[model samples]
Target: MAAAPGLAPDAPLHIVSNAGSGSKDAHEARQQIEAILTAAHRPHEFILIDNPGELARVAKQAAEAAVRSDGAVVVAGGDGTINAVVQAVLPTERPFGIIPQGTFNYSSRAHGIPLDTREAANALLTARPKPVQVGMVNDRAFLVNASLGLYPELLQDREAYKRQYGRRRTVAMWAGLKTLLREHRQLIVEVEHEQGSETLFTPSIFVGNNALQLEQVGLEEAEDVKRHRLAAVIVEPVSTTELVWLGIRGMLGRLGDDERIRDFPFRSMTVRLLSSGKKRTIKVAVDGEIFWCEQPLTFHVAEHPLSLLTPTTVK
Candidate 1:
């Protein structure tokens, strides 16, 4: 991949850290990051964000500052924070760096960024900027998967359940069960992609930009992330008992064997709600965060490539 032109070796760096990520205390993480940058003789500015709600604002400001100075922005947080930062920086020519501090760190992991903060920082110092494809739903950019129906509802319920009970597998499973029982509604949708159009009466639809993560769940087989296409999977509606069984199969990482799951790839896709009223809208989850988008929802590869600072060892 070709590198972006503006991010030179001596350009200044700006780092945005989310306070509530991972198991490490916010202060401790900041201290460690500062120490690593200092030891590397890299001059940088650090912005510590205490509230989740302020992340987008703070990141956008940092990205604007970085663009003005011909610098780069290093995001030190999980997927949600990274997603916000990516959106903020995508408009600029500035290169983006990542230090994974989230539970899954799917974006960083897919790009081969080291999970350890110190090591990730080292990779940042040594890595080169490479242009990578980004996926867009409506106008917002997402580096991971975007989905509607059961998955989004499950994500909403899981967060609420996690707050009340805890972040355990059992709690998550219970949350899934509760959500499915309460909010399991079928979607009657018309999907138009590069291949053709199809009418589907399914309970869920998932479109993936990070195909590796989809493969991890046995939903896809493609390993390439720079393909510049979206991988989509639709789950055929089934009885509640069968749905629970399917969920269990997903948990056991055997979803690929399930006959009801259909997978395909597309350069662009449009999903329209068949039962929609005059003003059509639906709640869709982009990289695990939920938002309402107007239908027919349009998805495609972003117009510009995202400049990413990734380890040279990562191919």
Candidate 2:
């Protein structure tokens, strides 16, 4: 594992955030965070990006300012915003102090940061950026896996359902069920790895650099990046019955015993679009944020420690 970056006792702190992204109630979240930080008596500055595509520019500028002033930055936004900042400041010594503001903050969840924005901000004072693992896909940094499957469909329908019936769990579940019935097509993925290769005919494949530490698995106290290796599981359900059965089993933690979830673990894997007679494209979701992309998404582990603040360590 690489040595964790050193933090100064008086390193200048900056908070980067978008005021409005998820859940309309978060309109005042930035202001609230600032207030909490001020109350904590921490020396800090807050920089807000008013519009889209400005996050990268603002982050670069802030990073430069930090360099000139000898400081660090704390980001308060959703997963996409965090991804943007991380991507913008790659290979630089600028460490990110993350503040979760997204619907499902996967990065924070992976790092064991507090879920509540207010609590997460306060935890910054005591927490140090520990040496943690990161995943890189074609040079794009992602805290979680780049996934294609029913996950993307469920996200689309979930949003539409939210429009009809405000953020209710039952409505989201119904929407997912309806989407599953409509889209029953299988996806064929040809996977290439360092040692060998294989083909899979399934609904989707989730190539994970980091196993999700929230909901399904608990966080580990000391995640030694050097000792651990990246794992990928390709879904291969031939029939609807098999899909449903395997999905339930996976969700119930029985996936270790299910054949479909068992695949070779590789240090790196590239998935190519292999559908014939059609323009092969799929909606990819990285850490719960969705985007459309063509074939051949690469997945591999990158060793880097993201500077973050947390109240206490959980294993």
Candidate 3:
């Protein structure tokens, strides 16, 4: 087999460490990355980020450094970190890489980036930069998925519970149940897409870009992603108990068949909050990171694709 045309053996790698997470896992990832590249005699440097709040700024700096050094921009962390770095790297048109330290690792796994630390680092040596589609929400990159309403609320609620109860799997499950049992206000919106338009009253709007994540949830719309389109899912307004049951069904990977849920595929969409009253922005969870985005959130495939350093086996 012909060898993949990758970066020069001595090309610099500007690695952003802990830009998304400050957990011990990130620190260990840093250590492993350093060890692998050092053994291979590769040129690299780590932009160690001690403060998670500086993720966006640090990511920009890392990307700029890679551009100046004529190297690749690499990130070590979960979806959040990758999302941050992706936003920076996209404009530079630089080779982007990731070491999957995140739990789900949807984006990395989707592109054949290994989950194992050493293997992921070693693969970076020979992987070629491949143009990959990316989804953008209000001009911000979301490598995996973007969500609004109950999903972000559930994540916030779970974080609160983790502080009070514990961080065990059981605690997390209980927290999700507790969050679902409560009443959630529906989002009344005017959704416009390629298929046409409609007004929807739902607890959450989930737009998926990664096929692997969509498949894991048993949603057939995963196929939509392969066509360079985004997949959307919304649950009809329902009672709290019924909503809780729907959440359970989702966890069981059987939620797609339920009548309460509706999903479709589209190239682009404009969502206007018709019932938001005076609110100018809403909390949106993009690639597992939460932030407030202005009204009329637009979701679509980015005009330009990301140059991802993907393993040749994947191509």
lDDT ranking, best first: 3, 1, 2
In the predicted model 2, the residue pairs found to clash are none
Candidate 2 lDDT, tens digit per residue, 22-121? Answer: 4455667766777876887777887778776677788887777666766677777767677777765555666667888766576787777887877887
* lDDT preference between candidates 2 and 3, better one: 3
Candidate lDDT scores, in order, read 0.82, 0.66, 0.85
Task: Kindly indicate the candidate among 2 and 3 with the higher TM-score.
Answer: 3
User: What are the RMSDs of all candidates, in order?
Assistant: 2.4, 3.7, 3.0
Worst 10 residues of 2 by lDDT: 217-226
Worst 10 residues of 1 by lDDT: 219-228
lDDT of 1 at 232: 84
Which candidate number has the best lDDT?
3
Candidate 1, residue 271: lDDT: 94
TM-scores vs. true structure, each candidate: 0.91, 0.81, 0.92
Q: What's the lDDT of the predicted structure labeled candidate 1?
A: 0.82
Which residue segments of model 3 deviate by more than 4 Å? 1-6, 19-24, 161-174
Q: Relative to the unseen true structure, what is the C-alpha lDDT of residue 299 in candidate 2, on a scale of 0 to 100?
A: 77
